[model samples]
Target chain A: METVKFDLEKHTLREVNQYLHSDASVLDGKAVTIDNPNGSHNIAVGLKADVNVTIQGHAGYYAAGMNQLANVVIEGSAGTGVAENMMSGRVHVKGFASNAAGATANGGLLIIDGDAGLRCGISMKGANIVVGGSVGSFSAFMAQAGNLVILGDAGEALGDSLYEARIFVRGNIQSLGSDCEVKPMDDTAKQILVDLLAESGHGDVDPDSFTLLGSARKLYNFHVDNAGDY
Target chain B: MGTKDQLALVRDPFACKPAIIAEHDDYVAIASEFRSLAHLPDIKNAKVFEPAPKEMYVWKL
Candidate 1:
């Protein structure tokens, strides 16, 4: 495969992004490495083609925003909005990520090898996020569709106001958000979890250790009886 | 459709915290309490509001 490298100390974010945009067709089957990122934001935003991007250091914010058909690997941590609004692709972070790791993403696979901060999968739409460590509060807030597999403890208000999305957490859940309830893991759900963990390169994790959380479906409509919960 | 769904589309819920705006010789760096302006590359310098909670903090670099 073709390999391209960009040194953030020498090249600006605009120049790097411009190169990817201009050479869209040529970069489809290539692997690009970014060095000396030094916590720069928006490093690989709006990538539309299939490419492999490897970031050597920490990313500031929105590291892979609106990404599609790309495989992005971050050797270090990521800031807020790691894969925000992502349509499709894969983002693997070897270190911890800050808040809003996959906010509003439509589709893709986000694998975090370390702890994730608040709102880890907020408003997620169809994406699958696998966190190898603990996650902060407000995770899966307003998540309409997707799967969030947390291998460690979850903070308060986990999966608050969640819809359709299924959450699998291994450790203690501080609390469940409104309308989110613990569900028994079925064969189908367990298999799905197992597959996801394997796909995210954590095949050793036991799916049986997870407890499933999903929408109760009782608060879909605003009924007066549920007004207090609302 | 739902309150949570609607709230997700609104402006960041955690904007009331302190913000930092550093203007250097070459580039300007802004750090809001909750949100980040690093995605926008064109902005140079300007007044930034916290949008809610009415506490103001700024730094000139």
Candidate 2:
């Protein structure tokens, strides 16, 4: 396998990303390693190739935002909005991620090995996120689609104003947001959880231990009975 | 509350600010950004994590 290496301390982020934005034919199937990331923002944003990028150190905000068909791996913790608005491909964060991680993704897979900060998947349209640890308050808020799998505890008001998206948790939930209700785990849900675990290298986790939560569909319409004055 | 001999840390309940904690065998450090700590000795081997909101942590010296 061909590999491209860059040291962020010596080269500008623009240079590295510019090389990444080169024609797909030149960048496909290549392994790009970025050394000394040192908490730089936008380390690998808007990559359209099918290459694999590895950030040697921590990443700052929007590390892999708007990614497509690329695989990005962050060796250290990621700042806010990691993998936000991704269209496709996979991003794996070996350390914890900051607030609004994986926000508004369209299609892709985000794997966080450590805890995620607030709003893990806010307003997600389509995508899948697997967190190996807990998430902060208001995770998956106003999500429209996709699946969020949390392997650890969730803070207050998980999935507030949810829509269509399903959240599965293997640990404790502090509280539920408005219009969010627990759902019985069926065969399909179990299978999905099983597949997600397998994909994220967590197949040993028992699928039966997870609890499913989804929208209650109570906020979709206006209520006239509760109208105090009109 | 802690004495000068102890190392303590805390996070806001809303968690709007950023904080990362790095613990090494020799010492423990906390910073708002990783870049500030990137020059530390043996940083790659440190255990890095974000402190939970509204939680107080104290490391005895």
**Fnat, one value per model:** 0.00, 0.38
lDDT of 1 by residue, A60-116 (tens): 789998999989999877877899998999999988787889999899999999888
Provide TM-scores for the models.
Answer: 0.80, 0.93
Best by lDDT: 2
Off by over 4 Å in 2: A224-230, B1-4
Return the lDDT, model 1, position A150.
98
What local lDDT score does residue B19 receive in model 2, on the 0 to 100 scale?
Answer: 87
lDDT (10s digit) by residue, model 1, range B1-61: 1242221112233331333343445544455421355333543233322222233333333
Recovered share of real interface contacts in candidate 1: 0.00
lDDT (10s digit) by residue, model 2, range B1-61: 4577898888898676888888999989898878778889998898888888999989998
Once model 1 is optimally superposed onto the true structure by TM-score, how far is the C-alpha of residue A112 displaced, in angstroms?
0.6
Provide DockQ values for all models, in the order shown.
Answer: 0.04, 0.59
